[model samples]
Target chain A: MKTDVSSRVVDKGQKQSHFTANLGSRYTIDRIFKYAAWGATGVSILILVWLLVTIVADGIGTLNWNFITSFPSRRAENAGIIAALVGTVWVMCLVALFTVPLGVGAGIFLEEFAEDNWFTRLVEINIGNLAGVPSIIYGLLGLAVFARIMQPITGGRSVLSGSLTLSLLILPVVIVSTREALRAIPNSLRLAGYALGATRWQVIWSHVLPAAVPGILTGVILALSRAIGETAPLIAVGAAVFISFLPEGLQSQFTAMPIQIYNWVGRPQEEFHYIAASGIIVLMAMLLVMNGVAVYLRNHFQKDF
Target chain B: MTDNVTGDIAPGSWSPKRDRAKAIQTIVKIIFGSFAAISILTTIGILATLIFETIEFFKEVPISQFLTDTRWTPLFASKQFGIFVLVSATMMISVISIMVALPLGLLSAICLSEYATPRIRRILKPMLEILAGVPTVVYGYFALLTVTPFLQIFLPDLQGFNALSAGLVLGIMITPMVASLSEDALYAVPRSLKDGAYALGATKRETVTSVVLPAALSGIVSSLILATSRAVGETMIVTLAAGANPTLGFNPFVPVMTMTAFIVQITKGDAPYGTIEYKTLYAVGMTLFIMTFALNIFSFWFVRRFREKYD
Candidate 1:
């Protein structure tokens, strides 16, 4: 007790005492934490740069027009991705065609009409859950439903099956993003439309929706990028491992860039590995262009809003 | 009073037409509402299908043997269906990935939320997220070609295919997921808390470590959990890079098969429908789904409970 009192008196007697000591200690810790944060960002940027550099160095030379134009051949010297490229484009087009209307319509209904009831909340949660479900699960579902169960068209493995599976995987993402975009539109817009003697449908069609288009397009593009790169579900739905021919219809056998890359890289040979890298370069370029457009639209329309 | 005022107005009035429009509005609302309801129904139906098939799969294969048996030889008539080996590989890869990803992810979040300028973050964060937008299959090839050779320099015993390479690449792939989610959490932290720390003569680092990070800990943890789930459920990386040897071991240098990989493997082969081999895919899938589902649910709860209580 005596020592404690003496220390307290000494502390009180000292003008700067514990305060300066605390400040010094805090300064060190603060600097360390800030640097730590900086280090993290630096490392992430480094990894991304490493990936891009390595891919470009390894794959860029092989990415010539001939590589894109030629068809796959059994001979290692002659094989290319013409068939796979065509298949990917077709699948992406079909996927976008199918998902846009259904996904956007669902988003509109939820944003404009659905009440804050238990049912609506349930639907909202369900959509969130679906978004987190892995792409592979969707593949298995596609295998069971599109390939096996409904085999009248595609006999269990075709471009159609692959497209159906990917569409399901990304549908939730589109819906959620679209709903967010719609929600960002202010209530005043709706009220003004009504005040002008416009009906609910007319108001949504004319004012609120036009305002929300940029945001909705952003979500749609992201969804497309996701679909374009997916491999697991397509593989599960029996995407041909060595498809040398182009797909003729929805039901015809096909391969995508990811599947082709997976098959080629798995080989023991070294050259096929390089071919895989070239395919990756192509895939990444496509994704970048899509994402770039999305960013541009977001910025352009955000300014308008 | 309104009638007297309007008595001088024309006979072709807007008020009656507006009433008719209101009636139409109610009908349109019902139609839109039904469309939303059906979208929900489709989602539910997918879940229903998975559950129904999974139950049938269990009936054919006894639950006890499926969980307890270690050697999975479902291809043969004997059907030695133990899922431990595959599950162990999944767990091992997931742990390694979390080790690599967590620090980088959290650090990046801290940088974006507390340190970086708005202009810098706008450019940097999206670029980082572009990594996420890259297909997993690309990462798979990068792992097999680039990462494996890199690992071979240090670990001489490392095979052409090993879990270390796959796990490392997957860790990189999942980094954006963690960073983005954690940043959102940290950004939600109110400025007053940081100001209070600064007013106490605390350094910027002290303010961030002591005040900002704690407030966002729940969000960071949930992000980690979600990233781990993604690693567990990841297929192409493990299938392509991680060698498909369903052996119950822990050596990172050795080839190990994961649950998702096994499902991919059987489906790739000519496994006939209704055969034990085909059914095993479902059984394995059910296990993987249950694990990821449970983790996701836990993560969702954690995010809600630990989220910052902002003004």
Candidate 2:
């Protein structure tokens, strides 16, 4: 009996140590994983910082008033971004003009009027897929349709065509955001508007639309920011790379900031790379401003009720 | 007598203004409906354009040659139209990108969702958003000028325009997207699941790995797939950084050309309308479209099939 009791005590002690050893390993793994996760996050932030620093360091010397004012030239030192910058402004304005009404209107129709049917479902699915469709595909569509089939109207790969293509590209984004913003407006608000004997259109126009403006604006700004940075679609639509003159109107052939940057970057000359970086700085500044506005609008106008 | 009395009262109640308002409402609805229809029209237009052009292309170049040709010198004098050359290069870069992106993205998502404090989460989220919002063209520039040179220090043989730098930059570019989407998925995993794991003496790491991640598996998978699709479709970084060498080899150290890059190459050059070279763009585009479209559909289907409904 004595021997058995001692053996059982020894076994219990061994089991405890084994359990603790297992836990020690587990705890070590937990600590390692925690640090690994932190490292991953750190690495991502580090890359962003590195990319910015590199661009600024490389481009700051080239970024001057002349760089912004002068037209693109064969000489790397002489090339300026005047033509591309103006073209970007024109395209952005037209994109905003075309997309807002169409995107917001579609969002309103889907959220307010469309019933739960196959057609609504199809539209919803189509938008989702369209959002995933590569921007280059949109470029091809623009190339084929707006630039070719509708050449008479779009003037063939003009600023109007580019803007129209971008409008289509970002329409899904705008519609989704508009729907989200509209969805956030309390049902009670709509109900109260109806209780006041307002028609559906009246309530949406006077109450819901007003409430959703900030959200829609935020979405629009972000979408425009995206549109501005876009290069491939414009390239596919055949935006000229060496235009010394600025676009006169919507129908005129144009080059935007990205195309100019792309053109500069493609050159074998190291000087062109510097100018490319400078152009990127300008583009980044524009994006930063627009994104700042979007973030501000979102935070400032976010409503609880 | 009742009908006469009702008719007399109805005119005043249903005023001309009411008729006008009703008419306006109908007109507005129709207009809005047409606006909605435009999105559909865009999709139809894309399909119609691609199909027509692609058909025209296939009429000239046999499908068998397109599939089997070992070389893709569509612009050259020899005119060999082998798509595998472009596909291989595209796949090589995308594979490299996914290699970099998946772990970084998944880990970031895990940390943000499972470990980060609210303060940290708030700061990190916007930072990631900023990363995402930075232009692809900028990334392309960074890849060509900064990353490739930096990479050349370690890899002496790495070309100035190679897949490695492009893939690396592309990976970093898409990481934020993957992280954001995966974080959403991880956040969607219910509290009860983690609690149960903890109650069973699982550590935080164990709970996340065995419980939360498993539950959020579908979403993470979908996010990864979507990011891969984005990588495949990515143009500027590859066009600028990955040189326009359409070789049928998977070498990250060397230059490569992706489908999107090829399209850019063709369009940037003067392939006037109604030419075989121009038609090749549509053919290649059709292939790219199908690839991304299939991946997207698969991702959507996966989410629908495997999403864990806690409610």
Return the top candidate by DockQ.
2
Task: For candidate 2, write residues A122-158 as lDDT tens digits.
Answer: 8998999998899999999999999888999989979
> What is candidate 2's CAPRI-style docking category based on DockQ?
medium
Tens-place lDDT per residue, model 2, B60-108, is 9999999999999998888999999999998888888989889899999
lDDT of 1 at A103: 81
Best-performing candidate as measured by TM-score: 2
Output the lDDT of residue A295, model 1: 89
Q: What value of lDDT does candidate 2 attain over all alpha carbons?
A: 0.91
Q: Give stretches of model 2 more than 4 Å off.
A: A1-21, B1-16
Q: Candidate 1: lDDT of A151?
A: 85
Could you tell me which residue pairs clash in candidate 1?
Answer: A30-B205, A30-B206, B69-B82
Q: Where does candidate 2 clash, by residue pair? A: none
The global C-alpha lDDT for each of the candidates, from Candidate 1 onward, is 0.83, 0.91
Poorest lDDT segment (10 consecutive residues) of candidate 1 chain B: B12-21
Lowest-scoring 10 consecutive residues by lDDT in candidate 2 chain A? Answer: A1-10
Write one digit per residue (lDDT tens) for candidate 1, span B229-286.
9999999999999988887878889999999999888888776777767777777877
